[model samples]
Target: MQRRLADNITSDHLSCPICRDTLKDPKLLPCDHSICFECLTQLIESSRRFNKFSCPVDRREITASSYTLSAEQWASSFPTDELSLLLLQTISGDTKTETKLKDGILCSDHPQNGCDFFCFGCYKIICSECAVENHRDTECNCKNFKNCADLAREKLRDAYDEIENLIITGQDIVFKEIDKDQLLLQSRQQIRSTIKKLKTIVQDFEKMINRKCVDILSKVDSVTNVEELKKRTEGIVKDLKRVRDEVELSKSLTSTKDILTVLSKIPESLQKNTDLLYSLAVSDNPIELKLELNEKFLNLCETLIDQPIGTVHVVPADTIDFEDTEATVCSKRIKFSSDVLPLRALELDPFLAIQLDPSESENKITARFTGVIIHGHSIIAIDNANFKVQRFRDTIENQFIDEVLIQGIYDITNIHENDDVLVTSPGKQSRLIRLSTYNSLSIISEKVTENAYFSISQLPDCTFAVISHSSPTSSKKRVNFDWSRGVTSHIDIIDVDGNVLKHFSENFLCEPNEFGDPFIMPLKSICCLPNGNIVVSIETKTNSFISCFNQNARVKWTYDLNDTPEGVCFDDGKIYVFLRESKAVRVLSVDGDLKPVSTLRLPNYFGDGYSLFVGRNLLSVIDRTELIRLYKLQSC
Candidate 1:
């Protein structure tokens, strides 16, 4: 009881562009359009004839990050469009679903024959004809099956178990949301307390201003006594006039007697007049007052009045209750991993590996690797001792295809949006070299430091962050914590033309710990995360740590470790750090707390871990022992 194809929801998305039919074994192109695997094989073959494989819709060349699989291995190279296939299955008619299962039961080599045997080793269903022809000499445990019923049952059981785990995890997430709500409530109370304290401070300031205004006004009133000053001045003038008249009268009197009396009276009169004049002089000067109103203070008050404090908003918590639990179980597949769900663990295997056998021969490059990066299909490595940058295909059988002989090559990193690689040379005057090709390299940039640069990584803005050891050194040791340790290191962001954009000193680089001591360590490696944060690995006094910094050059968080972290790279919100002593690569989340996601342990014989590059499902690790190992990550 299913809808017919004509009666069903049929749109452009429902049909494949190549076959114009329901998409089968859909393979997605780089442009995001998908077609059947069979159709893609034909398209690839046709494009191969023209020396290019491109998407049919956009005609853009396919340059997937995956290692180039041979012409015969196209099936393994491209990722299957699982979501498209699932959508097609959900919308297709019931007859088509049955036909789809039956289509898998038929053998590709012998369409007339039905596959009755399942090979557990190959994980493929084979017909009797294919079993005798292909599985006869193989080391496989083959079991007879009717129509994949048993296989389907096993898949169903796995799906059921995964669903149950999702149920439990979902419940846990709901409870965690409740905990967040409780924390929010506490934060709301704290905010309210802070607001109340602010109000109290404003009230206290108002009272202080009122007291100051009253005191200043009283001083102004007491100083403005004009009437009292005028009265004192008039009395002093009258007393002075009387003394003058007495002197005149004495002059008119007799000679000797008049002279003696006049002299005595003159002394008394002069003393009295002098006393009165002195009193008047003391009270004569006007009281001056100056009051300059503060323009900034007035503006601030007006601003405060215009934009008074409003009520703080408390964001409501998310609803945790489910509307229909039965519908959730019956409809969509349960989410397992919080990351993408149906919880997956990636199991890594060697897709392509090369243990370079370097011999002293003419026109041969050394295998000593100091740094590594993935450039398109090529895995590029830096030979620090030999001063050579070599490129090799990601395939196991491939040797160094091309190499650039440049003097003083220490490290190599990929540019932000270009295929170009940035090379670092610590002592060389031209510290950074941009490599456009294996044979082409130019000294495009130089480090802005008197000291030697250890490593450099490109930021999103095409600017490079270069690390210097804070002192010139010939020693191989990049980081030292003893008295012999170099001074504070520097992380400077420079443009491609060698212009210093932002220079971060020790004050900006260091992060304070629980004891409030800044973790000022020697910088070893630097890289920018996709989220616009720069991550640097440093060797601390006691151990090692990786610190992530925001765009403002502020430390977002610090991840401490026991082993010394050397080369580091950030991709897809995951940090890849190489542990020098332990010879392992640790992957962690780019969050503030630096949550541990996974770790890959390298063989001891691989030597000390130097650098690591995480490509799309591919990880390339370079070690001090002149070895570069590539791992193919598969989700299980």
Candidate 2:
């Protein structure tokens, strides 16, 4: 009968409201419900933005007024449910000595009496006399001290076990990180060795070409006498000059005998000159002596000059196929796979337009999506004008999934490994907010910045490339807008902790005034490719351009745009740039020197293609007209 009663209590009262399992270390909430401590911590963390959480059972909201406390402390600040603990102990058959230990704890206020009950209202262990004198008429709930102590012991034991498990997890993570470091070191060594070999081949080729050039010149010099030919030509020129002088002297004579003598000598002089010319022409002419190279040798040299001495290929570690041995370099054999779709070959399919205007918003602002990303089958966008982050299904109906309120949200980017997202809010309170999308849309944490961040992209190393822009008016009050005022823009590489690792400030063609200050162009958008190359769009007063930077923040190339560029994203190996004024998307190849591959003209209804996202076979664009258009991409 006792066991049956215990089973009924466990079934009715012992289950957690969140996990629906038997509550372990259950905490009592203000709404008179119990939940597992872990569930409560997650709730607090997820709702830290508002410093409040909704009870999973009753849907009642609980606010934590002490915002300085961490999530763990907030969860731990709740009182443990002594009654639930007592019931759990009763079910576990661990309450045999409860009666004997009922009087073990002495009351602090009433020193002569042993503590018998735990006062719920006062949160103190008290004797029967003290409970009657202080808490009895005050509506304080009381429980047996021995049962409460037993339950508290069990809770402590569970907490100890949790800590032990966490320690083991930490150790495992450390070991894995060490292994990764070793692999990185090995990879660096291999790269250095390969580069050294390539340099040696180039140096040897240079020496071989020098030796071949010397041999060809030596053979040509041994075959002819340049000095003797020059002497023979000079003697022939002297004889011709003498014959012309004699003819001129004879023509000046005023007698027939003198003319006849000059004419008789003319034939002898002409015959002698002609005979000398014929003899020289019959001999070996130096100009006619050509260097005839071996056909096979010339062909081999041309082939070597046209082809690359060696190629250094970099690929993702996961994509490397070590077993493929068809091509080996530096004792490493890798099989290359081509999975990137060609942008020029992509054909646009039927598109769907999804309305982004929220029905319940009180402000009637046009929806302006400044950032967008496609995660899984959902399209997430930042509604800049509406101050919200909205998610929707990528289908014909375009069903709304969820939306979270974020003030002054400017851009959104994905954290690929976990599907979480980072958003920038560069308004009165500039910050970078991270949101988790595992089970629901919830703010994980936020990092405040000194300046307003406009665009953000996640780097290959898991850091972030963010563009921060600060205008003079933003710092000081201005009665009117000044176009000549200098603005500052920086592309900052930041880690997960929001620490700036590196920053780059690009120089534009702006003349300094008397104060020697140059106006900085505003960076509009940024995107990071898989190979750690960063593409940033900058807008000057008259022109706009997109610059590609390598991992070290060195500019690789810059491509000029005909119109203002609003957003940029890398899909496969092509860079997709959205032009706001031209209403077009320009696709450029990363490996082809940033050459324009194709231009996708947006329809008139797209209305200023502000932001775009490209997936495996889908392209999503969000415009300023409160709509998100989805287009299916197919290989032609």
Which predicted model would earn the best TM-score? 2
lDDT for each candidate structure = 0.65, 0.72
Structural RMSD, model 1: 28.5
Instruction: Write down the TM-score of every candidate.
Output: 0.41, 0.42
User: Which runs in model 1 stand beyond 4 Å of their true positions?
Assistant: 1-347, 361-366, 428-430, 438-451, 472-487, 511-521, 580-582, 591-594, 603-606
In candidate 1, which residue pairs get closer than 3 Å at backbone N, Cα or C atoms, i.e. clash? 336-342, 337-341
| 182-242: candidate 2 lDDT, tens digit per residue | 6566677878898899889879988998999998888777654658667877788889899
The Cα error of candidate 2 at residue 304, in Å, is 47
Off by over 4 Å in 2: 1-347, 357-359, 362-365, 472-486, 508-520, 580-582
lDDT string, candidate 1, 361-393, tens digits: 354655677788878777778877677777787
lDDT score, candidate 2, position 141: 69
